[model samples]
Target: MAMYAYKDAARTVKILARDAQKQDKSNRYYCPNHKCDAHMFIRNIEGVSASYFGAIHSHGHINNCPHGASNRFNPNDYDEDTFEFDNALLALTMPGMSQTKKELPGEHGSGNAKASPPRTIRQIYSMCKAHDCSDTYNGVKIGKMLLDNRSVYMYPKGVFGWRIIEAKCKRPHFYNSIKKEISLIASTAGEEYTFILKFESEKLFKEIKNVIFLNRECFTVVAGQWSSSGTFNVFCTTFLSKKQLAIIN
Candidate 1:
């Protein structure tokens, strides 16, 4: 069973099982892992549990596919108190730049030099999903600044709609040439929250704009620091790359 699946044969777009229920059944679904060719179908047993994707009997996932091992996100595997921010697994700077190491909890010395390389946007998105978008853990460092949970906004549950808006630019022209903003609204039960993404790249902005324009309902995960002011409205002013944002519908 898997919580996510590719919505198209090209495997460029991913869709959550719960969200897939709203889509037409005629649409094809495939394994989220690009290496896996297993066909998937929605399984929504009315009273048992939430909707999810199940592999067809004749089509099985490949041995090397991560989904083949286990697609469920086990919360027990992650403890916020013990969770240490892995800079190598999370982008602090843009892609292609060398990732710096942050000192682990109760650890001395420069840092772990053998740590793995930074993860892709999809990998970071998967990690957030596995943790249910919890941000109560070791802080994430960008440059010389360390941002705690208070300054971070995880992927909110029940994201229903989003839109792009013009934002004021205050950064130096030589460093930041483009400025765009996207506001995502998520509502679940009786609660509502707006997550904002203020970026400086026309390419990233266009990518997000196209996804929202093409899909009726989509999910987005952004890795950045939240604005210091706001209750229901949370915004980020961090520079973003294509690898820092993950969009699925």
Candidate 2:
């Protein structure tokens, strides 16, 4: 999940805090999922929170789970405390929250966003696995960043609609040279075909928010950080595009 998606995720961590507070050595928090214990060391995450967020941080030593042989998280056993924790944590998950139009499916203007030129649904699933694929994702990180920040996964949902038009100008001069007719857009996605931009060279190094043309319509560039230092070039563009496979809301 995008970190921005969890701007309020810390609220859910509080729920984990309450549920974890009462347990002693004989009782430690474990994964509720019967099949996965490797991910049970959630307290490891808590320690970092304490050092950064506030005064509360329980070293795994205090919980006594010792990597295995621990009790599982059973929400049925707790009230007010766990409830807050679960809800707060859930806030960060798709299961825990509702979708807003702002997060449009990205691959193909399906309302989401990404780095590579948008893709078709059939194509997205073909490449799905671990980092690029959805079925094999395990959210481990390097430093503070999830290794797969550029990835996108969509659950089943109802009909989605949009168009995709992309154009890139490698040279800043080329950007100025493009005519308004080349930039102004149709009244809606349904009215146009693919508009792909592949500019060859660009001079600027700053992030782009949105590019405005002669027309009032807008194409937003979602901000993301790179994993390594590299000079990237190009003035970009996109129209609209859509694919439908997400069944979950």
Candidate 3:
């Protein structure tokens, strides 16, 4: 009774929603009932809980909406609808991050130059925290320095590696080819963090699937974007890996 499909600010556009509600730009969201004219607005159902999309009026035409009256609605369906709507908005809002290329700090040569040593996860985290990370409205600094499609070298020196902690995929894989994964990771200073990794690749995906089947705690190196989160989202993943995971440096 607290979910609806709607457009976001960039008009890109769920829950038991746990994240802090930000500056939501969309004013009107569609009701689940196809024939209902009752629209919804973001409101805090519980005094201290995260905000959800609910009917503006407490007692009115909204009471007739399928989501408003809440006889027996499917939670999965609501989640799916919201996921698709949000992804469309995201595609419109985020720049083509996955298609761009940038130079990293630790590279060695220009002409026939040796490849720079891959920065460990801790090193990357240290650099990002100092330069690229920013504090969101939720009062937490989110990591944004990692490139989406580039190779990220992670070392098993400390507590860094992929560990399946939870599944944060909010949308159906059919909506977009991308897959969302949640894993336990650590920064350079040995501080632990959980992040969401959104990616799409046949080979890498299959490799992860195989590793998951074999072991959830494989100490393999990976490369992908380290995206930040607002609230409910918490998956950061890398699709690339080094041939050898031993820490040579």
Candidate 4:
């Protein structure tokens, strides 16, 4: 399926809400919650890959009443932080980013930054585009928007050879607990990939074998290993904002 990036959720929510309203014209203008005026309904859930709503009830977000009044909310209204990732992060972790990061060593220091390192051909291209907010690789740039800001803020100066890794906790509260997300998002361009595997403790490899055997993807290990060293071909020349650039800015 063609995935809709998280930033696009606002647009999606409007469409869904309009559809839901069409299902019952009478219910078009009210929140479904019997107590809350049906003000809030599903605007856009995006890749809510998980079946159950995690904390909607606790947060007063669920209400299915057909006639009940509900508040009008657009999924796009909520901050991007509420979702796991934006588009840029998703695109970066694709299978190919690992080799790309490793190869970008020459382009690292070519840009304006004195801190530039040896970057690859791809890295050079992305760094220049991302730093300037140019739409060089549109999808790739959008993907970066999905990444958590903490990881991308330093921009061309901060990340190198990075990839997002899975969390040790099967039931992570949010993507934040999922470590290396910044690195993974940063890896989207010519930068290298780094995957992380979480273990119960810093035990021996044998003790962590259970975790090892459970790897669902190989990049998880490959990216993790590469992340250990700061030596990546692509280095961020400047920090860029994926969200604003993709949508508002």
Candidate 5:
């Protein structure tokens, strides 16, 4: 089951099943994976608790698409160092900086090889969820962080890298188009915390706004440097990108 799907055939816009159900049924939906050409349809069972995008049996996902199967992620199935970062600092930078490097002439066949694709915020979030937030890869701790007074003391300068912030509120609490700011609530250990995310670019803000509007009850995995001023004053830095945010159920 997929939580998101492309709104159009061009796949530039994303739509969640909850919002898609309100749209005209004539509209077509595509696989969330851009690399896949599979067609999808909104699935809202009569007694199910949630709705999701399901792939049509006739138009299954491509062989390599991660969403092709519903199997749970098992870290033991792969090499322990599979998710290790080559350069932790570089990976914590902006999105474009973590792209795979091109291979030289003899690099393909020789011991030297091309770099692997950089991990996305969603991929890291998946690992955290699978391990219940106790797994650590390359010195980076993957776990839940409370948005309370203790968090401010722990990360005064803010958190760097991909981190999961469990949503406490079902919907966004605040939005400011002029300042490009959005505020949301997060929870850990039963305590709720609030944080504001300010987008530096209009393009990025619009993309995030679209997701927030569509999936009001989902949580977010944020990438970049997060800073806290007081117990309730937490926000992100300008070092963020569209790829740094993954809003999921």
Candidate 6:
């Protein structure tokens, strides 16, 4: 059993089970399933991944709740599909069916739709782990700077729904020649996020060139750091594992 979704008093965000404990227990967080009455405030079990919102526990839910480990009513067996956390997070962020059609989905687009502004890394991190964020601030020298300046630092953990487009020439200093940078974009679901790879002649860059850049409409993930302005600092690029990009077509 795992907690697939949660709604705090102020915000509704999909999260891992470990994060549920951070919510304010007074108002508490709730499971996403409408019929599931299980509250994550009580359901959360620290260090135990199996215990989550929607998991079967002492406090039971109605028949319609899907969190039951096994379907007693159904005699036949079915395949249990697996999904990455990012995909689940994306689903939780999306608007419901009752929302206006113009809102649609994705991080961006829809001129009339008032989408939440893109959050900085600090903001995203803060939202996901409010309790730990203060600790994160104390651990890094730049943390104080971030708080003081209201700047967001991006240490890219991964990218989704984007594929390599091409390498492009960026302006260079007066004494230097133009620099090469890779480019990618994700457009599905109306969210538009562009990636500009800071070029390096490393093995990872070569792999991206040979595998992702060469292929059309391929999805890729990346790990890297971003400047305060939210630009991907290609120099800080980190290669993602095969597993991270495997789910993408």
Candidate 1 local lDDT, 30-61, one digit each (tens): 87667788877776653434455667768887
Q: Pick the candidate with the highest TM-score.
A: 5
Of the pair 2 and 5, which is ahead by lDDT?
5
Against the hidden true structure, what lDDT does model 1 obtain? 0.45
Per-model C-alpha RMSD: 13.9, 18.7, 21.3, 18.4, 14.5, 17.2
Query: Roughly what TM-score does model 6 have, to 2 decimal places?
Result: 0.29
Question: TM-score of predicted model 5?
Answer: 0.50
| Candidate 5 local lDDT, 80-157, one digit each (tens) | 254554243236446565433232111121222332322555444443443312324444444422222224334444
Candidate 5 regions with alpha-carbon error over 4 angstroms? 1-72, 76-118, 144-162, 168-172, 188-190, 230-233
Q: Between candidates 1 and 3, which one is better according to TM-score? A: 1
- Per-model TM-score, in order, reads 0.40, 0.18, 0.24, 0.22, 0.50, 0.29
Residue pairs with colliding backbones in model 6 are 3-53, 198-234
Clashes of each: 0, 38, 13, 50, 1, 2
Top candidate (lDDT): 5
Model 3 misses residue 154 by how many Å?
16
**Candidates' C-alpha lDDT:** 0.45, 0.21, 0.33, 0.26, 0.52, 0.33
**Model 4 vs. true fold: TM:** 0.22
RMSD of 5: 14.5
Q: Order of all candidates by lDDT, from best down to worst?
A: 5, 1, 6, 3, 4, 2
Q: Cα lDDT of model 6 overall?
A: 0.33
lDDT of 6 by residue, 45-95 (tens): 344232234433565545634344321211011111221223332433333
How close to the true structure is residue 199 of candidate 2, measured as C-alpha lDDT? 24
lDDT of 3 by residue, 1-249 (tens): 443343432323421222325444245655434455555665553333324455556423344333454322212212211222212222322323332113422222122122232233422222222121232112322222331111122222211222212112222231122443434343334333444444355564465545543444433333343344544323354544321111111
**Could you give candidate 4's per-residue lDDT for residues 1-249 as a string of tens digits?**
001111122323222222343233222222222243222323334553211011124344234321211211112222223232223343333334344433432232222212222122122222222221212122334323222222343345433333322212122221122231222222434433232333222232233333333442222111121223344432221111121111110
- Model 6 bad stretches (over 4 Å): 1-50, 54-179, 186-193, 202-204, 214-218, 228-249
